[model samples]
Target: MVGKCPSCGEWNTYVEEIVRKEPSNRRAMGGLETPKAKPLSLSEIEPGEEERIDMHDEELNRVLGGGLVPGSLVLIGGEPGIGKSTLVLQTVLRMPERKILYISGEESARQLKLRADRLGQISNDCLIVCETSLEQIYVHIKNTNPDLVIIDSIQTISTESLESSPGSVAQVRECSAAILRFAKETHTPVLLIGHINKEGSIAGPKVLEHIVDTVLQFEGDQHYMYRILRSIKNRFGSTAELGIYEMRQDGLRQVSNPSELLLNQDHEGMSGVAIASAIEGVRPFLIETQALVSSAVYGNPQRSATGFDIRRMNMLLAVLEKRVGFKLAQKDVFLNIAGG
Candidate 1:
């Protein structure tokens, strides 16, 4: 259970063995670097037009840059109970007969199946596993060789090489790095779900974001029923792509037009309410901006914002009254996004 470190070259730095996975009959195919390979043709190495999957949802397809790319690493992150797992589970289930391996460190197969059943009839090719160790998941992936792989939440998976806890900075970083290496070497597309901290950022190390090919953050206010999928980093597709969805009793329905979902038209022509178009990735959407100006009853004024950047709004208001020649410097201002 020992191997030399690739970086430090320290003998026995890696524990080659850990909580072992169940055996499988699948074997890795030799890569292009095989010794017996024939001379390559110009067209052999030339890539054809990218092919994509059609999951019957335009918003999801748009976020995935027309569709899921083969051998791509996609990281999905979100706040708790925000339907990160639900969206992916439903998508994989509804996919058109593609072999898929799903591993959940937090839930068992029976539990996932119960939810899948409630989601209606799913494809038979999707398989489920409840595992915590990265090595164990790798074995299942190698054996199944599924078209798609989904890790429910990467923060729960661990690698034995690091002695730290599973969700710690070091473990998250190392585990993600190992998974990335395996996916690239094997040319198997993998989807990793992640937990976000209270600060609205991914819980693990920042480097975890750098390791993955695509980073998708699922964002929505707990009080609101609309959700947004934003691609922060994407090597295979446009980084500016945005996906919109609405939470209904059945499941998440794609919102082709987000303007209706993000704006509240009940209060027409309300003061201090402005609609602005914000661009994420390569797509642009309309979001309502709400502001309230109240007299400073006491000597000290309070500046508060919900869902919007407080500091930036403060700076903007200051610029408005000072440089832009607006009045009322003594008023207190409150700002918030309609549905964040």
Candidate 2:
């Protein structure tokens, strides 16, 4: 006689199972929860001054919407070989008054000290630890009670409850969640260094970005000395703000006047060069626009542009021909935004 399984509703899916009871020993992976508070009306809530910690870097401070807010979780992501670690370390070294905990899951204390020495600034209050276990990290946090905490790279840290390996989706999600909970409970600001995937997005689930208070992206070509720190998401500030830096041997230097440095001072009388005024996050600056017009040597004219949108260039060229009455439609035109 055939018997159907009630759950699966299939005759062949039925099977005998053995159940065994095991003692549960897994401890909760979050900070101690406080007693729930009653909801307050909007009018009953009083706004207090937000204490911000200065990073001592003007560019960084501007990108962070004036300064770093306490109890905020900020994530900085970038491509490999970018100056993400250097930027964070330099900022931390400048803050001598604040007690900082530099947690490194990828590097050792000796290596960090060596880098700090090369940077030529050392803070006595700064502490370094080479650990990867999330639980143990929390223990150290409780013991040290630092004013600011920085995680070198979140992808390298993991928890014991997760069966997946480090850098996995499950591990990254759980570790970030734990950190967020701890930050909120302790009212301590946490800075997280994150890895970017091939597509340039943060290497984790989308929910990870949602949990953070601010998200900053460090972007630049390794071949170039210029780097841009941009805010992708900011709960307390504007997302349109950006910071510029020049990578040097000692450390990353803030570019106070990016417009002056970006413009070519000697190219005033040069042909095919134009200067245009632009605004980036309330700052007005001048930009150099260059155009190159040449005869088409091949049968098909090649059009190229850099640092500016290609379609916009095409539309401008069409306008020049139609409105300005610039003949020579067969000529090749190339445009570029200098020092982009």
Candidate 3:
């Protein structure tokens, strides 16, 4: 094992692996003949809008900066139970005209079927396959010839080309590269669901984010029913877009106006409660903020904040004392975002 990665400059990140090279024809991009280079000036290139496929879900489409682009690679990463699979499956099931191939490396066929039944959307063009091997996945893709492809959790996929285990840095890097080639060659859009590490970044090599055309992050507290989808990187659209969803018994439902759900009208005259307006991307919404100030029981006044930054809370308290002539030195201050 290498002490550090030469490319990424991370310590102890390398793993020894045996690479089995295949024939030229078996490779995704190896069989093509060499072509002469052609240079074009800025004026020579044609400018046109990219063709996008409507996901039929407004919240999802807005986060994607309009719609899904054909032949693009989109990577969605989130916590394990963040409803990544449910969101993708629901979107594909809504489109009955498009031929979609849903490849699950983590869940079984029966499990997906049960979830689909709960979603209550049926599409005859959607194909489900439980596969983990990269070679077998490609074989199925070739035979099916789908317009769109969805891979549920990329960490579970492994390739025979490498000796390393699945989810390894080398394996993820190689497998994603091969899949990207296939998507571009066939002009088919591919959606990859990924797991986030403890640090909240997508699991596997950092290059996985760099390789994809778009990188979306699914975020929300599991306890809370609301879910947020944010676009971190987009090659064909703006990155400052976000989508919100509400988790229900049936499935995830789109939340167009999140402010209405976050605000509590019943707490209008309640003390220590205030309504604050916040904007995410281009959308503005109101959020409820709760503040409690009580006399300190101990020698030191305790300062605590949840869903809101404690440091910011402290700064606010200092402003109140100095600017507003409020003596809060011996008080225990607590702040919280009510709907988190």
Candidate 4:
């Protein structure tokens, strides 16, 4: 049995699996043509503005610079049941003009249909296929010639070039590279969904993030209805861009003006409550901050914070005790962000 993993430094994480090698002499399936190469001077190349397709969703478009860039590979990652697929499906379903091909490796066609019905009308001519073999996926892509491509989760796709199982480090890396080459060569925009590990990073090799053109992280507490989409890496847009959405029974609803829902008017005159303004992307909104101070029951004082940095809270407390001459050292302080 393996004791420790040299790659991730995790212990007792190895599992037993059988791998069958495939022949390398088989015909290529990814439709990647070897183009003739030639060297050119910097002045020989022409420059022009990149053409971007409008995503139709304001929040989504803002996070992706202005719109979706052609031939770009975008990867969206989140926890289980965090609405990664739902968000993408809803967005693509709204675009009727674009011929979209959605390839699902984790769910069946009927299962996806059920979710789509709940989401709303399918405006686009979207084709759904359930497949895991990377080679066969290219065959479907060649026949469909879709304007946009969607891969539900890259980890579920396995390439014949590697003998390792799907979701393995080797498989994820190779599959992503193949998809990247296809997107660049075909000038097709691809939206990829990925799962995050327990450590809150994308599962599989770190090279997966580097391979994509853009990386977005969907985060929020499952118990809460609010979800935040943050851009961790963007080759076309600013990384500081953020998108906020509210989960609903039908689907995700965009929050254009979040200040209205975030402020609790009922807590008007309550002590230890205050309102603050914050900006995410280009939208500015107001939020509520609540603080509670009480005498410590035990000899040691307890400091806790939710939706805010605890270390910053401690530093603030120290500032109050020293500069403001407030005796808060022996008291308990609890801070929370409203509607977080």
Residue 245, model 4: Cα distance from true site in angstroms? 0.7
Question: Per-residue CA lDDT of candidate 2, range 254-323, in tens?
Answer: 8878786558878866899998888889777788888899999988777889888998888888898999
lDDT of 1: 0.81
| lDDT, candidates in the order shown | 0.81, 0.87, 0.88, 0.90
Residue pairs that clash (backbone atoms under 3 angstroms), model 2 = none
Give one digit per residue, the lDDT tens place, for model 4 in 1-340: 7899989999989998999887332345466453434899989988887899988898899899989999999999999999999999999998889999999999999999999999876654999999999999998998888999999999999988789999999999999988887788778999999999989999999999999999999988977899989899999999887888999989999988788667787896689998878776677889999999999999999999988999999999999999999999899999998776
- Give me the runs in candidate 1 sitting further than 4 Å from their true place: 1-44, 159-165, 168-174, 269-272, 276-284, 292-294, 323-325
Alpha carbon lDDT of residue 156, candidate 3? Answer: 89
Count of clashes, each model: 2, 0, 0, 0
lDDT of 3 by residue, 1-340 (tens): 4798889999988778899976464554333322333899999999999888999999888888789999899999999888999999999999999999999998998999999999998888999999998888888887888999999878988888789999999999998998887777678899999999999999999999999999999999967899989999999888887788999989998988888777777886689998878787788989988889999999999999988888888898899999999999999998888767
**All-Cα superposition RMSD per candidate:** 8.6, 5.9, 9.6, 11.1
Kindly state the number of residue pairs that clash in model 3: 0
Question: Model 1 over residues 1-340: C-alpha lDDT tens digits?
Answer: 4477879989876754568776331222212221233789887897776677676677777877888877678999999989998899999888767888999999888888888877775778998889998777767775787888999889999876669988999988888887776667667788999999889998889999899988999998778898889888877678677888899777888887777766887868578888889877665778998888989888877788988788998888888988878765677888878766
lDDT sort, best first: 4, 3, 2, 1
Q: Tell me which of candidates 3 and 4 scores higher on TM-score.
A: 4
lDDT of 2: 0.87
Residue 147 lDDT, candidate 2, scale 0-100: 97
Please provide TM-scores, in order, for all candidate models, with all chains considered together.
Answer: 0.76, 0.88, 0.87, 0.89
